[model samples]
Target: MVNLSVATFGGGCFWCIEAVVQHLKGIEALKSGFSGGFIKNPPYREVCTGRTGHAEVIQVSFNPDIISYHDLILIFMTSHDPTTLNRQGGDKGTQYRSIILYHDDTQKEIAEQVFEEVTSLYEDPLVTELKPFEVFYNAEEDHQNYFNNNQDTPYCEIVIDPKIQKLKKMYADKLA
Candidate 1:
């Protein structure tokens, strides 16, 4: 049996992060979802209202032996602008906020350490929240693997494509 480590993160639109992280090695599973909220099983619409307190998140199950948590944290930090609070790019509000909902103590420590290391290199402190994992409500069927299915959509072309391209160039050696 293959051992896997799970890390859930909310950074703008899940499709952007999913498309890039999916290209990484050691990633066993990546599901777009919602978490870090007051409500349970929050619907996409509800989360978008920013009242249910949910953030769009991706629960990534990866193999630690193949890709270390430090590497994963770096990917998470670089993929989105952690300096922005409750937003990323054109996506605004809490649903699009940056958050790292860690699964356990080790993940928490790695996340904090990575944040510190990353902040030291940049002028802006990481605004990504380090929250405890409570529940992950899978996004609507249409939101799953969105870029793969809706590549021609305006959002995909204008937003996701550029992000994916940047990730490929930045993490070329780590791509699957």
Candidate 2:
């Protein structure tokens, strides 16, 4: 039997992160969601207001034997601008903040090490939040697999395409 581990993080828009990570191998399942919030079962509208205290996140289940959690963490750290505080590109608000919600102590430790390693990559101090995994509220059905289904959309082409290209260039070996 294959054992799957979960990783949850918010690097910007859940759509961007989901589009990039879905290309990687060993990813059993993925869901665009919100986490690190104050309220329970927060809807997309509420979270988007940034008053809910949640960030847009993606929850991933993968086989570590094929793709290590360390690599996942590294990909997340590099794929988005973790150096920016509560923003990615034109998207602004606390809901757009970069964050990593670790599922356990091991994931947290790996994230810390990865953060240290990636610290030199940026000129600014890394602002990616590292917190224990609490709850993930799945985003609306329309938001799931957004890039794949809405490739023709301008946002997908402009914002998400570059991320996918970078993932291809940087983690070509990790792609499925």
Candidate 3:
């Protein structure tokens, strides 16, 4: 069996990122969480206040044999508005900022390369932050698998549906 590697990203709401990344072929698991924060074991409500310095992040465990880290980073950059700082859609706060928490020096290097390559795609300079990985506090159980459980909800329908459709169109070959 191929060893699984982990990647953590904060690009707005964890639910949105989780919904899109979970569909990728090599992904073994996806957990919505908080990272890059000063507080320890922060709750969802606390992070929502945007004072915790945490970004809503998704910790993804995937098999690199199927999907390279470079490809995953590329997908992530395309999936979110990296040009926007501290926000995605109507979600605005430090918690909604675009960030990649790299687990190692190699991941850090790769993230930089990917960012440089994709910078020209946007008219504005990409503001996506690349930081060394730190602790990840899993989001509350109620937030797990949020899109799948709350598909009919207005938020999911209005905010996440289009992202799913876009993922399907852009990465059809990578879907599980």
- lDDT by residue (101-161, candidate 2, tens digit) is 9989999999999999999999999999999988999999999999999999999999999
- Each model's C-alpha lDDT? 0.88, 0.95, 0.95
Indicate the TM-score of model 1: 0.95
Q: Provide the TM-score for each candidate, comma-separated.
A: 0.95, 0.99, 0.98
**Each candidate: RMSD:** 1.1, 0.5, 0.7
Instruction: Count steric clashes of candidate 2.
Output: 0
Candidate with more favorable, higher TM-score: 1 or 2: 2
Candidate 3 global CA lDDT score: 0.95
Off by over 4 Å in 2: none
lDDT (tens digit, per residue) of candidate 1 on 1-176: 99898889878988888887888999999999899889988888888899988889899999998888899889879878999998888889998999999888998999999987889766777789998998899999988888999999998899889878888888887888
Candidates 1 and 3 compared by TM-score, better number: 3
Q: Model 1 — which ten-residue stretch has the worst lDDT?
A: 117-126
Relative to the true structure, candidate 3 has a C-alpha RMSD (angstroms) of: 0.7
**Positional deviation of residue 59's Cα in model 2 after best superposition, in angstroms:** 0.4
Error in Å for residue 110 of model 1: 0.5
